[model samples]
Target chain A: MPAPQKHVIGLVFYPGMTSLDMVGPHQVFGALPGVELHRIWKTLAPITCDDGLVIVPDTTFSTCPPLDVICVGGGLEQRAVVDDPEVLDFFHKQGKTARFITSVCSGAEFLAKAGLLEGYRAATHWGMREQLMTNQGVEIVNERVVVDRNRITGGGVTAGIDFGLTVASILCGEETAKMIQLLLEYDPAPPFDAGSPEKAGPELVEKAIALMQQMSSLEFANPVR
Target chain B: MPAPQKHVIGLVFYPGMTSLDMVGPHQVFGALPGVELHRIWKTLAPITCDDGLVIVPDTTFSTCPPLDVICVGGGLEQRAVVDDPEVLDFFHKQGKTARFITSVCSGAEFLAKAGLLEGYRAATHWGMREQLMTNQGVEIVNERVVVDRNRITGGGVTAGIDFGLTVASILCGEETAKMIQLLLEYDPAPPFDAGSPEKAGPELVEKAIALMQQMSSLEFANPVR
Candidate 1:
């Protein structure tokens, strides 16, 4: 028999995490053959996504086995992640043993704060670029995804899926990743012309900021920094 | 105050479902402002996706509230959905109350089985076109997505995200949907040239089939049809 598959991807889920950031990658990684995907969260109790989608973890952090790859997604919950020493310690300790460490969107911020991204090239949600730059020794790249060494970082929330596929290709073979992509039919066509910071004109981008500003009160209540 | 945004989207999640089929749409719909995306499952316990991706539900069959849109996703679960009397009854009742009733991939098969697709143009995952065409009074379309009256259908698993955005635009406004798409940067670039039956060459398709055939025993043990 072929060498028993050795990779086990451990994905961390917490309350208020962006659903797509986790689920998008989950879909891509889970599709691979001979690989095991584990949803690792603080509790076995169902956790709700930032947008109210609920999911149950396959294993709690306390019981999770050592992972080959450890991924942490970002969202409004970053405040807790940044402040919780236990979470930081977990990342620092577990990341040391993992062959690859990855983050999506603001998740890179947490890893950076945890010292895992020191002297590393990283990517994060455009909106949080400034905040991420505040951390010392971290080189921020403006791209959909960045892979420097064994650490992979993705831009914003949806970029996690693309990042996941790329990581899977790196871990497995390119053929396996390509096959999974075909199975999912990931070709996308947005109805509108706008999707990128450059594509969404200044006015639209400003409007998006204005809309986000309206939620400033809530944002201040839960600042990630 | 602007009428308390009360848009409700009922997402049908069942056993043996392809997690991505429902998840792709969930990410899109959940991103909409003032929208409540509910995972309506048959039971309160966690439901596993085709490849062991498990998700918990916000509401169960006995307690789900009325919906503005009802979205049914397909997977290996189609066999159970097509034969379950209670599931059919629930779909019929929910379809009557929902302003829009939609399906992704083989989910159209369930809608057709429920007698809800009669006199409507529908779409299904290419692999299940013949199964969808057999339904009486259902006009099968080859498009990635099709909208007929209050009925909407999408092809395959990943197409559900596009369908969900289309439905979000119709229900909310094009501007709102565009804003969300822009925020998410919904553009995609698959590394491979294959995704659809047309685009994926006969050789690659045959290879895919051969790979699946290798797992035919498992497929039949958990057959969708």
Candidate 2:
């Protein structure tokens, strides 16, 4: 008997991308049977994330295979990523025929730059909503995970788990997805209730925004990429 | 003026380990100010996680500096890792003066083997509870995150996020952790409630257990050391 056909997933890698945003979904998709995961970057050199975690890409643009799903994670470098023609071209080429074009956090901005989110309702990190809206024809929704047609976008860093599970259910079935969830022990019990701007209150929200500004300014005086 | 002292954190890495288990806490701690995160492994070679994600260790056992916190994430290789004398010695050396000793999921088993969890109430992946109990003097608490003295353990994969945040709050303060929480946008909304055996029902749990068995059998013919 022959082995089952594989579901190839390509997660785009760029310097400064948030590690959790990519890892959440990668863990989910990589758990599925007969699934192949490719960490695609322009080169195979190690990519240092925003938080200093270093991940090595498994595939490069020239060597990447056709993908059933193409995912991108977000970071402070979203604007720089959107401006990169090489990355945009890669997304355009792979996303044109991909069954699913997905993003986590400000990764939606990259998809939007590739014209994939045009006229599509999407979700993104709350902090990046205004920036994402700058891309015309995209209606930004403030949900944890938004799905419209084949475009799936998740909110902020931690929402990737929900987004990944949702996509897993779609790709496989609920039973399989549920089993994966159980294996992951996806039950969440946050110690604090300050996960969002509204829940975190005005003071915290202001501090969080300022924190992002500080990080971006300090770390990206010259973006690594 | 001298810079504030850095809180150095060491996350143990091994082949066959779950990526999410390590990535979750690493993301949270890495977001904090004056915190240095270390991915310590046996070598500088890239460690391929169970889900196929490749992460490069920033430090090695012999060269790793003193840590404020020592963390181990769980995986199928937990048993093998516990048996490896080098790893145990490394844990022992670092665990001696570390302010906090921690684990996520089955990673608790490693700490238990290192005698770090002796006589302490801890948490681990639900699936591994029975196995973890075999280690004498340790009380396995079935909570999302468990804190007993300086020993902290998280329930399972996704629980690492909550665990990380809790630790962050302790290391920094409520305000800083809250800001990190909001920055990560950790408002979790799982599509299904099948995260635990009770919520997943008997049939689903059986299937999950069987799936795990199949994976272990097929993937660990020799068990990648």
A196-215, model 1: which lDDT tens digit per residue? Answer: 66776676666665655463
- Cα lDDT tens digits, model 1, B1-225, are 686367898988887787778877787787677888788877888888776777888688789888888988877656756669989888989988998999997788788988899999998776667656766679887777898999988887778878877887887788777767665656655556566656765555556555644632212111112
Question: How would the docking of model 1 be graded?
Answer: medium
Query: Each model's DockQ?
Result: 0.55, 0.84
- Candidate 2 has which clashing residue pairs, if any? none
Model 1 alpha-carbon drift over 4 Å, by segment = A1-4, A213-225, B210-225
Off by over 4 Å in 2: A1-5, A217-225, B1-5, B217-225
Per-residue lDDT tens digits of candidate 2, residues A1-225?
A: 676567999999899999999999999998887898899999999999998889999899999998999999998755566678999999999988899999998888889988999999999888778766766679998799999999999999999999999999999888888988998999999999989877888777776777788777312110111
Minimum summed lDDT over a 10-residue window in model 2 chain A is located at A216-225
